[model samples]
Target chain A: MNKIQDIQQFLQDENLDAALITTPDNVFYVSGFKSEPHERLLGVMVFKEAEPFVICPLMEVPDLKASGWNFEAVGHQDTEDAWEVLAAAARKRNVSLEKIAIEKSHLTVERMERMEELFEGVTISRIDEKLNSLRNIKSEDELIKLRKAAELADYAIEVGCKEIAEGKTELEILMAIEFEMKGKGAEKMSFDTMVLSGPKTASPHGKPGSRKIQKGDFILFDLGVVYEGYCSDITRTVAFGEPSEKQREIYETVRKAEQAAIDLVRPGVKARELDKVARDVITEAGYGEYFTHRLGHGLGISVHEFPSITGTNDLELQEGMVFTIEPGIYNPEITGVRIEDDVVVTADGVEVLTKFPKELKIIEA
Target chain B: MNKIQDIQQFLQDENLDAALITTPDNVFYVSGFKSEPHERLLGVMVFKEAEPFVICPLMEVPDLKASGWNFEAVGHQDTEDAWEVLAAAARKRNVSLEKIAIEKSHLTVERMERMEELFEGVTISRIDEKLNSLRNIKSEDELIKLRKAAELADYAIEVGCKEIAEGKTELEILMAIEFEMKGKGAEKMSFDTMVLSGPKTASPHGKPGSRKIQKGDFILFDLGVVYEGYCSDITRTVAFGEPSEKQREIYETVRKAEQAAIDLVRPGVKARELDKVARDVITEAGYGEYFTHRLGHGLGISVHEFPSITGTNDLELQEGMVFTIEPGIYNPEITGVRIEDDVVVTADGVEVLTKFPKELKIIEA
Candidate 1:
């Protein structure tokens, strides 16, 4: 069944009168229209009995229809009240507006209050969990796009590694990587393209700056690209020159942990167990305290999606599930190393989508 | 007084016990620490009678401190409950949490419900309007950064114009413009860079694709850059070659409307009046219906900020208020033309931050 039909089925099974899907991602998932409306209202109202319709900025109506969204679209101009338009559309549908389910995780309190006022005495229910569960399993078409996106991400890392040299600033290297990616038809980066060198890499979420690369310093490249709406994220840390024993050890530890976590990724394995497998490898090498973050997160439409792979999550791995396995060890006084790869869980094993090598490559500078 | 003090005073004046700021822009505005937590909890709790503190991801504590946030930062790991950490921090402050104001426009329903459970029976009030009012006026330092950002944006448009030629795809031109901007030290674009040509320009929010430019086609360039945490947005439409009479007429109409709107940017002028000044010009040119969107929006730390300039808003323009004056006329069958300028309302008149020329330029192809 199509995604919209699946959502309608969910509403019927859950006994929801209708569902108010907010957030650009959910809206795009339900309808084939994607828009970054900023503060403007953009939503899809799906009913179990009635047809689904989209309410968005009037300027976006044509584009929404052009995106293959065949449902009715209620457009509101800047001068008009968007809520009134949404309410009118709901009234026109003649469906039960009571007991409407909303994406509570994405809808703001202000919008929620407005929605309540629009539909007085309506019982609002949270559908965030249901939506996440629905989005977790990847379809074949989604996987195809995801695999292509992964290929682009791997190519980005390759270009970044080749651009590395002594005296080149991290910002310059990042620019080269993104420029090449754009040239190769990347719609945009999944997230900020991070390229941190030396001690700057110690910060797990460090921004690329004007810090120049030095001999023997480790440079970390964590970036992703969006292709056909799906996303791919990968991280690889390489040495600019012959590394010290400490740098090499840290790099090797992270590589082993990442590989072990990937090896454990199969159907029926708990997410917590995968995280533990990686953490144990780093802990055995005496870098337990340095491994600060979670193992990885689910990756698809957004870089960080549902089902986080952390030490506490008990979500079992399932076939068709796609996520990342990134293990890192960071010590500000020494070095930081992270190796990430996108993976898809198969019936019995896992298919690694990102093909970039994780072995520490010492580039002559 | 600093921004934090301003919020504390607002809390006291409003008889609220404290304020919880959750939006990233508001957090950065209040604490000088900016972070994109990506679903992770990051907020600042400002008390009326006690010291303020920040609750953020553990990995961001050091960076928060480095941003000159001297307050106590309560950090939580992925395995820990961030709300519990926040509760502890609030308890340590010993401030009354009975009545707290929150950014209702930004805090999601899920987070609001969690906060409600954490502070059982707490009286939650909306402070979104107050926050918008506080951030509406640009400080001198902020204006300085905004001016620099505007300069960078103008430079980007210049680079984009130079890269434009017949047979060059819109995506290629956009890539060239962004690559040049990055090389010139731009941290990031304020919004997605739009380079639409010919019929594609009719969609005001069109994304740049692989459509190559052709002779007599109008190319729209709407882009901005972020510098020193401030944002600048500018839009200009240029002709690829000698344009038809219709294209030239539409281009001149937009230019006239933009100039009329910018000329009306002064202290004591109503926002609605300024919008009318532009709308009147387009309406007189027989393209009123074609001009679909609002005249413009406020621009600062975030590109699209508060005090939207529309035909309905009656808020009076004031000194230190920075906004945009963009006017466009789009016809799908023919072409589209838009001229935009970032302006700061001065005590007497206005200061145009974006200095790129608005006159239609006919580039040889």
Candidate 2:
């Protein structure tokens, strides 16, 4: 982990005169401040050799003050016209027009145009890759938060599973699960608590509905917990009653695939190759075509980040990078089966962050 | 309602060769296709003198087809990039994109750059005013959906008030209200349900917490219901048990301001003037400085759209424009009060869409 000064040294090593951090993850990684939800204000941390300055809306000054971070804080009244304040800060810092690096992935065309108006005759290029390289490895503090988040999710899911019985609607189950998380002291949910059941489970990202819980239905429960700005995600599918022969077969197939994917998570392994590890298992079982969407994605500040684990991704897995390994077989009209776990690449192998049982569970009520 | 021919004629009258509609509201308004959540695709509907063409991702083709709109649909493979497909569509139409009018208000800088690359040699300017004008006037179909959405919110709020009592956490009440909306068949919540109680209510956009409801505390519940694509927002503040003298004073002041703002909403009235109608009441009550944030904002496709009802807003209210008239007072460490309702300006005066009772209710446990 680098101090503010060490970050500048890294920037110098990367040949970036000054790197502008805009995305919330990049800002939290560099400055350690996580803004509230739906907040439109941006956090800009400019790196010189040994200094970093933050620019945000004026309303957030009190919050920045409470964070105890050592950085210059500049504020503007409204974000709609905050370029003048940011440009003035740049001028005050004696930043040259050339050699300025900004986040290519996060900066919008309108913001760039506004920057152009403020910092006239400046050369700007992408510094996102360098930032991503730094953020790919999580710090000890990050891991602690991640582990706590996973524990909260595990606890919430345990209670949610107990609440899933015949006659309960999908909406009721979702509320019960979220309520469990709230009771456990979670600030908010990492994502919408998914409680899709029966035929609706066929849609991987289906919103919970008022469908009543029926016997002999494939129930897909994908949920997460957000604790201290970090997130954890997990998915578990269960049979409400006596499962059909096809359901039993598909459940076994997905379980084996998920185990293979989790086993392949280790340092020095390519994320895409690991995805293929599970993808191949499902394909060999002749359910490859039914498996839709990516196997997994990186989880961090915003729930979905870099180092995606998909068959087409080429990024290599590294120590400290955490992500989910979720594989599913969706048969739209009939049923679906998916098993997910959050895995963090360790020095030698991998550590499963989610501790909930991954085996198929049959609950009859 | 005007057909595609009318849009083409409107584009011609505006002296724009081609207009790009990218915002979800504008896209649905023109093409009648609701964009799904988590969709990385964009809908670019091009108008050329009485004809329209839509360019959407291949994965969305099925849903778009079912929409029953007669337009050319381009579907690219899931693995393929979306920008390339959009570029090909633009070329096939032979659209001379020079001097193109675009939705600068909502288009991201990155997406706008991609549009430039597709056009190669073209000028793009803001079409925010024209598009906003088109979306502000509600049609019969839109009104029906809006009314339905309002009904759901009204019902949910009634249930929420009935359940509010001492010994309940804010998050519990919020989840209950949201689940109630889902029970009645809401596709999704318009936005995150806000259940700010006690002193936490001082912040207009405060997130719900585990703070238990207490006796003599003012509870402010702000929530919205989403039916189909349209949305409705309503806020109600009630006292747990009997109110203190200060609580009653603040609540009555906010109620008067809220009523005044709603009464001032009518065709030909300046939006700023309507905001002042609320601001004046709060100011006269000696809580002007405590009333942070805007008086109200437009409510339709997005909760906070255009024609913001603020002291600085310069736009004039018009017929068929629906928005919220919410006036609030925030006293940190004490209590807060806010009353909001959805109101539509009519040819004669104004029509309140939400029918929830506003009289302060005292909940006894």
Error of 1 at B97 (Å): 3.0
**Per-residue lDDT tens digits of candidate 1, residues B1-365?**
39888998898889999999999999999898889897899999999999899899997899899999987888998778899889889978777899989998899998889989999889999888888898899889999999999999999999999999889889878878887787788988888899999899898878888888999888999999999789999999999889989899999999988888888889999999999999999999899999988999999888888778989899999999999999899899779888889999999999999999877899996
**DockQ for the candidates, in order:** 0.56, 0.52
- Top-scoring candidate (TM-score): 2
TM-score, chain B, model 1, is: 0.97
Candidate 2 is scored at a TM of 0.94
lDDT of 2: 0.79
For residues A49-146, could you state the per-residue lDDT of candidate 2 as single tens digits? 53467777778877876876667887778525666776777677665545567776567556676777776776677777777677677888889999
Q: Over the stretch B172-263, how does candidate 2's per-residue lDDT look in tens digits?
A: 88877877777787877888888888889898868888899888888887888878789899898888888888888899999999898888
| Superposed model 1: Cα runs more than 4 Å off | A93-95, A162-169, A211-218, A239-247, A331-335, A359-365, B93-95, B162-169, B183-185, B197-202, B211-219, B239-249, B331-335, B359-365
In order of listing, the candidates' clash counts read 0, 4
Best by lDDT: 1
